[model samples]
Target: MHQKRPHVLGIDDGPFRKQQDGEVPIVGVVMEGATLVEGVALTSFPVDGAEATAFLADWVRGLRWMASLHAIVLGGITIAGLGVVDLRRLAGELDRPVLAVTRRETDGSDLAAALHAAGLSERMAVVERTPPAWRLERGLYVRAAGVEAAEAERLLRATLHKARLPEPLRVAHLIGAALVNGQSRGRV
Candidate 1:
């Protein structure tokens, strides 16, 4: 009997300047069981206000490896400043599991205030509708749709190599940063 490796598309946005509005480059790395780099997708999305779910869903659907993908993982729920990626909507649209991983728990009140101040109050609703983050090992928090907490954890665990984060995400972060800054400097 042959066992199939888990294939995941992990997404992360490049570093962007605050108080500035523009599109931010993002990278998506596809991996087979957190070891092999299957492929990479490169794109950009509007910053601060434009929602990312539709853009991402359409982009992902166009990928050549879409059929074999086991999951879509995001570095964080929010990208390109205040732009929010709706997990539920993405999962429903793609008919596949979608998960977001964050290093720290968010401060809901602070985020709401920031969004309101940025004149993007509607973004708060997306945050509110998202399911709570489940704590993974070493302060990693995961929020997933189309999959339960246990399975989400298992998926993440199965997708990790030597890095603390999944290989797809880690590589995507490095690529995005290097593309924008000549070289990656900070932790993702």
Candidate 2:
């Protein structure tokens, strides 16, 4: 009973300025089972903006190898500070299950305040629509779109290697970090 390992495309964003509009590098690492297969990079607006979802969707749609992917994994639910990703829209655009992974539980009040301050209060509805983050093994948490929590748990367990973060996301994080800073270090 040998089951084929699923291929996953993991995405992550690089560090950016908090106060101004700037370009942040977004990296996507494709993994077949535990093996790294491909990597792609794109840019998105700074924190508390509305460009991550469309940029990600367009990048995924343009990738010829995307058809082979079983799912999409994100390092976090937001990029460039408070620029929240619309996971549901991304999943619908790609027709693939999407999972956003985080190392800690998020504070809703704090997020709301930030959105309000940024004049992005309307974006709160999108965040509200996102599935709650579920704790998986080894202290990792995840919110999924177009995929069941149980299935996401199974995939996380299957793909994790060397750290709490999955390999694809880990690689993407490292690449993004290196691109922003000269080196990649600390928890992403």
Candidate 3:
């Protein structure tokens, strides 16, 4: 019998802040499963703080599902965004492979430095100097072993378009942001 491939988890963080009093801080995380564009699954976590760092830190601390992941993909914004998150640090905490993607021309030296500082450079993959507008929503594709790098790469490239966020992360972003947005408004 053929075995199913493991799902690659796509991880990303975003922040939420209120302009007025009595509002709660919000951070959004989107974790997507590897599959076809329609097969991706999304889960989100929201926390306090306007800084992306806060969200990342919280997400790392609260990450209870890493043991089942094959690999992790992190957004450039999440790595470079402000707050308390250290991409390298978080990668060190996990036993899985970590890849960081960005459209910028730089080497993502900062991210690499941080990961190296945390002793996780070996597990980190940086796809830098990519063409413009590569994609808006950042995420990972969870896949099973022996799935061929070309196949995985093809799937990732096909779905991550300029407009539509990857399904898993897109749904998670919406869920997390809406959750906080509703709370800030005191809505049901």
The local distance difference test score of each candidate is: 0.85, 0.79, 0.40
Model 1 regions more than 4 Å off? 1-4, 186-188
Off by over 4 Å in 3: 1-5, 14-64, 77-81, 101-164, 183-188
Alpha-carbon TM-score of each model against the true structure? 0.93, 0.90, 0.42
lDDT of 2 by residue, 1-188 (tens): 11256788888888776785667777888887666566555555555557778877888888777878888899877877787788899999899889999888885677788889888898788788878887887888899998888787777766687788888888888888899899999864
Off by over 4 Å in 2: 1-3
Assess the local accuracy of residue 102 in candidate 3 as a C-alpha lDDT between 0 and 100: 41
Best by TM-score: 1
lDDT tens digits by residue: candidate 1, 129-175: 88888789967888999888877888888888777788889899999
lDDT of 3: 0.40
RMSD of each: 2.3, 2.5, 9.5
